[model samples]
Target: MERLEKSIVITLCNLEKIFPPSFFTIMIHLVVHLASEAKVAGPVHYRWMYPIERYLLTLKKYVRTRSHPEGSIAEKYLADKSMTFCSRFLHNVETKSNRTERYFDGYYGASTHTSLTKLEHGQVHRYIIFNLDIIEIFRNLHIEDLKQRYVYDMINHFHIIDISFSYLFNIYV
Candidate 1:
């Protein structure tokens, strides 16, 4: 924004010099405020009439007869809603309402097994350590306690990693 603001102002200033003062109307000045206004109000879809307009357009498409659009829209809407309501109980057959997300991740409660390389494992650990937001004082105290305990036990790093993760795997499976 800092960089873009300078360019926007410069362009507007250039236009001011190129044209008469009367050319700079309220609408022209409002161009500078669009980005800031969108930031304050959030994306256009959330704050604007876009979703409502889209739904109305869909309803408009339901109009089959020129005599009464309201009746056609109402009839089609009720049919669609009733079918959606029924589609939930239809486990055997595929339906619009029961379709998976665009990028499907397999069926619900299903998962894939993955093996992480040592470098990938270290990267993940580093990411969590840097990004996790536990209270700083508590985290420091926990780390100090672990250091003291591990140092007192004089356990080698390899021995710690040798600890079996089978107990965790057993519980999950």
Candidate 2:
């Protein structure tokens, strides 16, 4: 613990040497006090307000009425609490909490297993590649490179066939 404090002090002093004094804000200054605070409080996670802040944020979302936010939040909170309690007792009803998980149930009408056939996989892969705007320039550059490489008669013949095949499978389709 003492070594850690010394290490932090040395590190902060080194940082001070490299960066201007004005760059050290309150947050940066707070780092020097963290080791002592951790020693006093045991651990940072035990003292975090994230869960309470998150729940408060959720409650804030329940406020539908602009003029009477407090009343809206209170009413929604009560309604949600009652609904949750009722859902616990009702086995047949499809409350949000009681519904099967989306992953297992395939709730979006998608298949549970994404086992595509080879042709389907190829089509999907080709669709994604062709749709990417950044790759269009690269694709054109590659076709130019192929034309340069296959300038000989026999290779040029194969290149013509390849070009016709690519034209048949154009984006215009």
Candidate 3:
């Protein structure tokens, strides 16, 4: 737990350079620390940690549906492009299944294209890149503080984005 706290402190300090000290950054760090600790601890910890996980999960779901009124044009563009790339990739995978059927002959493929199309893949992708961009922006804003925050922030941010994306996708499809 000491190691986790140290890492979170280092991450918070690093993020502080670009993000301006805010509860948002602190919550993000705390959520990440708890997530990591939960993984190492047993099911009892998971049961105890349910409230935190549930809160984070709720935040993620809200973020997924909410519009980004403050996002820059470039950020929007990258997100759209990433979503397009992912959608196209999913489409290709679904359509090309039979092209390599020898290996998956008996396996059944469920059709999900219709549901997938309804998903705001662009927004989902954008949310992810936006989180990553936060770290990059922080790094660029304070190169001198690189070591103090980069690794843990990047890891936590990525994990959060991934969890959020998965949650949204599960709901969408």
Q: Candidate 2: list runs displaced more than 4 Å.
A: 16-24, 105-173
lDDT of 3 by residue, 23-127 (tens): 464357555567466557745644677889896665454443246633444465567667666666674555333245566656577756543343487566656
Candidate 2 lDDT, 1-173, residue by residue in tens: 77787798789889999999999888887887888888999887898999999999999999999899999999999999999998988899888788887678455665676789998986776665557796677556555665676664644464453454356446534
Model 2 TM-score, 2 decimals: 0.50
Q: Model 1 TM-score?
A: 0.47
Location of the lowest summed lDDT over 10 successive residues in candidate 3: 138-147
lDDT of 3: 0.55
Question: Which of the numbered candidates is closest to the native, going by highest lDDT?
Answer: 2
Score candidate 1 by lDDT: 0.70
On TM-score, the stronger of 2 and 3 is 2
lDDT comparison, 1 vs 2, better candidate = 2
Report, for every candidate in turn, its global Cα lDDT versus the true structure: 0.70, 0.76, 0.55
What digit string (tens of lDDT, one per residue) describes model 1 on residues 1-173?
A: 55665577889999999999999989998878776776678777677888899998999898997699889899999998999999999998889977878897766876889999997986675555435675344445544555676684543353342232223223433
